[model samples]
Target: MNGSPASLDAAAMTNASVEVVRDVVYGHGLVHRARPGGPVPRALKLDLYLPARHAHTAPRPALIMAFGGAFHRGSKENDAFEAEGGNTSVADYCLRFARRGYVACAIDYRLVTEDPEPGTTPVVSAPERIPTSRTDVVRRIMNLPPATPDMLWRGIEAASDDMAEAVRFVRSRAAEWHVDPARIALGGFSAGARTALNVAFGEKVPVAAVVALSGFMDRADLQRHLSGFDGGPAVLLVSAENDLDYIAEATPGLVAQLRAAGLHCELLDVPGAGHFYQADAVAVHDAHGATTVERAMAGFLRRTLGG
Candidate 1:
């Protein structure tokens, strides 16, 4: 809202227009044990949502929506903000899935803090400065990490392990949530997108598909590893031309490599858009207006994950 377009607020949210009711699964937001050597301790939590009335179906698809905040900041609760409430909200997204007959889960992963103090600003011990010319400031602020590949890898590894554990935790308890363990999908915005991509391509876990929104994917070793990895899940790279310079540059090459590896991939390039389209309809308007981008994303999700 501060740095993004003003049009997003006034633009019509078509998804909000739909008439859908959902029953949320509350109190299920509990932490699961993390893999050894990951960032946060073994106590990381996630929230799950399913069509309250439709839990009897078999093999129902599930979505794991990871909130973006550069991996340093953000919570699964952020997805419930009033401005982005309703259809754009993660709850709404999952509810839409439930309405369409799928289950959705949103997870909160570990933030990159050396000594995280609750309710205090997280200070990242990284060489990179805030508001840099080389990186997207918002992303940098959210995913504040040391300016080195090793640090990034460590953060990502921790996140991947947490995410993997989350998937397994959900799968292990699939009967309770009425979800199909084999049909789980991973998706996130920005840094969360990177985590999703890493988990989907990495050998640590098995994901059916990946939906990376305004994501960055330029780790050569990770790319190389994914290139050789067999049976990796499909990917949907969603972004606008104006999303972020680094993400824009890295995604195409990643897509090319994934395709070469015989993996299923699709790139949805929105016009005139920047990062955080869901929260700001003005930015969505700036890019190609809200209707177009929302429909595109909704359609892409439906097509890739099934309606």
Candidate 2:
């Protein structure tokens, strides 16, 4: 909440609106984990939200987002299940950003496939059937009742690759979309945050910044995969005061590790919230005025991206 002031007034953009271009295919990639038969590529898509026509004459900054679902269930379209007015979904974030004269995208990525039933045929026998994993963040991380450390790593890698692809896809279409490719940032909630961090640090893609909400990688993973990480984007790490126990436990170490890598990182410890909330439900005061998640994010983007 405390840094460079917001570039725009948060309250004045109430009447702003945006247009959505949905189901646009960006590329194809294999799912988070290999199926019974082998790897199969799936279409990667995104819903682009552009500032309404005439909203701007020059290229605008872009924000590419990935939704959180523990790398299991969820889509580029929706977010944590809840009603926070227009503050709840991924599309909502896109709409808000587009209204403020920025291009935004909600992207698709591979998810884990459900285990085959005992004595039942697997996915290769029925490619048309949908595959799923009802696993949640807690289950995946703790490996509580069942151990799945390997599966967790594979899913994170797969999802991170897909997110990296999304960044590349947006950059490829920068001219057509009137986007400033160098200013693009990556963000996500919960599991999506984990994926975003992975892409920003692990991938070679050079994003301008990153906003991770209630998400982070394990300390060991950070040391193992990102020890050689060099210059990368500035980062804003948001942790819900009441976030999952494990995420809270890992945050300090994560922040320390990021800083140790010579990266400029800031932590926003959001009070009175958990893993998810309405976009504006939580507010913070900057020099500009009281700002919500939407405005804080916009401000961070503007400051880091120089929009």
Candidate 3:
């Protein structure tokens, strides 16, 4: 943990005192395609991590996160270092934030390849109207590989909807969780980060802040969305120096666009790192001295969510 913040170390990253409630269903709906037998409702679930009860008496701020697997394969419990037999899963992030007095949730969304039936729509909130022109622009900005042939736009849309529902669900349970509804934030990595951006800017979910890692959006669309924006949620746009080409190219532009729109946006580029660093793997040199990705993320949440 070179250049690590004094408050952060490997030993203190995952707080054992945190309470995690796994597989908590947040939304229920039909799959995009029917199963072998018939169309059975799919329950969208999340793992909720609550901080240890303390005498400090303020409702905890909350974070709702989504996992990334290119919108096709991922789990709320997927450990970033599973191949190495390590226990650094999204739950580690949740636990770290929980210990700092924030309620954290890692959620599941409908994957692109979940059920491949044509013309079958899943039950979701009223679809947010996305202009065809905007979709075309986003496709160009993404610059995905030529090998995959399914509809990428559809997956992005569906995932964003699921994230919005998660936000609403957490807000609804604010009292039971002893959280502050107005202090909730959204975050994710890779594809999940893209989903968080969609919910924040596209779906217009009233969240306090957004933390997007290795993710970006069309600069033109971002500016368009920020038209007449009176100080929207603060944004932390993070990416690796060696991230995927498209992400490396677009992240800086998006950060510039957000700042030009007079919004509070920060950028953290992890030098010599790639797109898939674990929560605490990459270290960043910031005002707080040497900081890991998890530390940077937690600090951002605290600043924007009043933790």
**If scored against the real structure, what TM-score would every candidate get?**
0.69, 0.78, 0.78
Q: TM-score of predicted model 2? A: 0.78
Report every candidate's CA lDDT: 0.57, 0.69, 0.70
- What would the per-residue lDDT of candidate 3 be over residues 68-97, giving only the tens digit for each residue? 666666689773633222324565677777
Tens-place lDDT per residue, model 2, 32-78, is 24356655567778877767673456888898888887666678877
Model 2, runs deviating above 4 Å: 1-16, 32-36, 54-56, 83-87, 114-147, 224-226, 283-290
Once model 2 is optimally superposed onto the true structure by TM-score, how far is the C-alpha of residue 20 displaced, in angstroms? 1.0
The local distance difference test score of model 2 is: 0.69
What digit string (tens of lDDT, one per residue) describes model 1 on residues 138-174?
4455564434533344455556666666787777777
Global CA lDDT computed for model 3: 0.70
How much is the lDDT of residue 258 in candidate 2?
78
Candidate 1's TM-score reads 0.69
Residue runs of model 3 more than 4 Å from their true location after superposition = 1-16, 34-40, 54-56, 79-88, 115-150, 285-289
Against the correct fold, how does model 3 do in TM-score?
A: 0.78
Model 1 lDDT on a 0 to 1 scale: 0.57
